[model samples]
Target: MASELIPNAFLASPRSVRSSLVSRLLAAALLTIGAIAPALAGELLPLADKAVVLAFGDSLTSGIGGSGENYPQRLATLIGHEVINAGVPGETTAQGRERLSTVLRDSRPGLLILCLGVNDFLRGVPEAQIAANLGAMLDLAADASVPVLLLAVPAPGASQIDPLFARLARLGQVRIDLHAMADTLMQPALKAGLVHPNAEGYRQIAKAVAQSLRDGGALISR
Candidate 1:
């Protein structure tokens, strides 16, 4: 059975919202009612050891609407370690694949948290190609013996990418369906269409990631 957990509501500081517009009332509600999933695995890695968490993705990972409330930074505190934010605004899976080598070379993180593909959606890129890019990235990580956590993208509001995510999951990638958690991330305050997450959004993503890591046998409990 799927686990059920939600985060308490809190006001998110205003930040730039790019893209589609959301209703103010709705955005407000989302920020106030955001929920989080349960932590999946329990201490896959020793708590005393430091983990290099690489946050790879587009502007959403860049903290687009959240100033400093990016998921990776919030995750650092949650996981108690240094998280390297490797997200670039307007980057697609293809660009991410092209730059993977440099990111890996520099970060060499023990744990990699990949959140991408939003740009691809914006550009109407084929889902198959997007999946291919993701697969290539995962393959590279596998070759390096680095554990990977793949965050699934939202289904473009009425468009779902579960099939793509499932394909990646079948290949042994630890997957978290951020799409399914969108309700928790969406509120009255999030009228902007761009792929930014508010504080509640970050909390939901972080919680889902933490849970997936725990369940996938990738992390250790405190």
Candidate 2:
């Protein structure tokens, strides 16, 4: 069940849609959501004691279309730490993979929240290449002994997440929040444009991530 994967990951944000029609649509669409199976046996190196959280991704993670507050910023408050925003606009997975080592060396964060691959998907990049690049980043994190939390980005307007993210999560590289992006981007009111989200939308994403961490035992309840 999805509860095993993310523990109530299907709950939609209250502010995502305003209209009754949109709300009903969003709710119906997200009902088909998929979970990233928890396949890891070994635990992460205690995320609660970790001081810094590095949020890595493209424009969505950068606060584009948001009012200067991105999900990472919102997440910092929720998690009680600084979340280094390493977001680069228009970046694809390949480019992000190329730059990740340097960012990792510089930030040396205790937790790495990866929210990538959307640009690659939009650019029509082959799925295999996208997967390979994402896998490389995960490998880099493992090599550096840093823990990871993957935020899955579904194809735009898609109700269900692609199986690719689930496959990657199955590798035990990270605990994956498999539905936040899909839910955030699918709602018209929550979106700033076709791909990016507004400020409140980013907050919704942050809240979902915080919840996922709590459920996975990376964060203790306050």
Candidate 3:
């Protein structure tokens, strides 16, 4: 027998079972309202169908120093789904991991866009600890079968964290080179600053990530 997909209704009231069922049916009917047309197993799922896009990181992910466009918010428009911005400014890898349980329990995101490490580097935290915290979060996501897109902080004018980004790649993990993307933002035309990007820069990063997923055929069905 095909395994029965457990309904979330058990969390609702017994007296409301009929109403709950009706509501789900209505929701199914209204699903098209968001223009997020559901993708079936036979069809490739669009970015919109991806369960959740969790933006977990520091200020950059929080849109700090930027005007109004954060990468995660822009990524949502590009990908078409609910983007949960869990970024807290001034957060370090340890703090992020400490808060990971709340985010995981709340969203159960399908994709975790991790943008940490800058604070750790700034505070002169040991690189090994940084790596361990990150690896632990990645493991958490892995345990839940959620894919990750790790974005390392860009090397400052003279300092580069390319080694960290490369490590993620070497591990056969999904990682995006936002450092390079940030480099693009540093261009005279797209210049923002050493820390955050402008709207155009966020768009560039989002487009790059979206294209990466498209190219890799990483969009998965829920």
Candidate 4:
């Protein structure tokens, strides 16, 4: 683990994210819909029958700690579609940006579940470069006309999506799930390690994504 903690300035839900519910409640009460609430749900992903979902990210997406049952695998069962796990351990945003084009071409997916960028945080990459890499990936997906559902990957010890992720949703014109991993990583029972989640945690993340798909008007079977 990196000795230096990520400066709180970059944190979206800087707290344990367990407190986000209360924070949002207060925001609502104060009539201020700030970045804390971010874009949890927005435009729906255009999913087709037998839609192929390619989940792209890092070790978390690959089921490193989940004993082979990762979130994408659980999500495939949840949504009744062919979900491809396209995760690589220790991948940074720049690497993901470069690899995404090939994955998008090969997968030819109808929907993309992107849970990336946290690795860049761990490596202390400049925030601007990370944001640029993520933007480029979103552009790639958009160019393919593949709808995306981005899950904001939080930093270790933090529960909510990074603030930059919120901006990406707007720029990419994509729907985002800000709570799934944030909520999952914060719970000790849900974690397999300090950051990665176990099978059950992955299950909950799948459930959350499935719910978002449903809410976004995808006709998911269970």
Tens digit of per-residue lDDT, candidate 1, span 149-201: 66767646544444455445433334445542354335536423445666667
| Residues 1-222 of candidate 3: C-alpha lDDT, one tens digit per residue | 000011122222243333323233223333232321111111112344647878888877777655788777887777677788888988988899888877887898766777787777778886556666776676566556556666656544534343544454323244454443545445545546666666777777677666544543445431
Residues 40-139, candidate 4: write the lDDT tens digits.
Answer: 3344534777779999999989988898779888988888889999999989988998899999999999888888877888888866677677777766
Rank all candidate structures by their lDDT, best first, as comma-separated numbers.
2, 4, 1, 3
Q: Which 10-residue span in candidate 3 carries the lowest summed lDDT?
A: 1-10
**Alpha-carbon deviation at 7 in model 2, angstroms:** 16
Q: Any idea what lDDT model 3 has?
A: 0.58
lDDT of 3 at 20: 29
RMSD of 2: 11.7
Q: Where does candidate 1 stray beyond 4 Å?
A: 1-48, 177-194
State candidate 2's TM-score: 0.80
Which residue ranges in model 4 land beyond 4 Å of their true spot?
1-34, 40-42, 220-222
Q: Clashes in candidate 2: how many? A: 0
lDDT of each: 0.60, 0.73, 0.58, 0.72
| Candidate 1: C-alpha lDDT | 0.60
Q: Which residue segments of model 3 deviate by more than 4 Å?
A: 1-50, 175-181, 184-192, 220-222
TM-score of 1: 0.72
What TM-score does candidate 4 reach?
Answer: 0.80
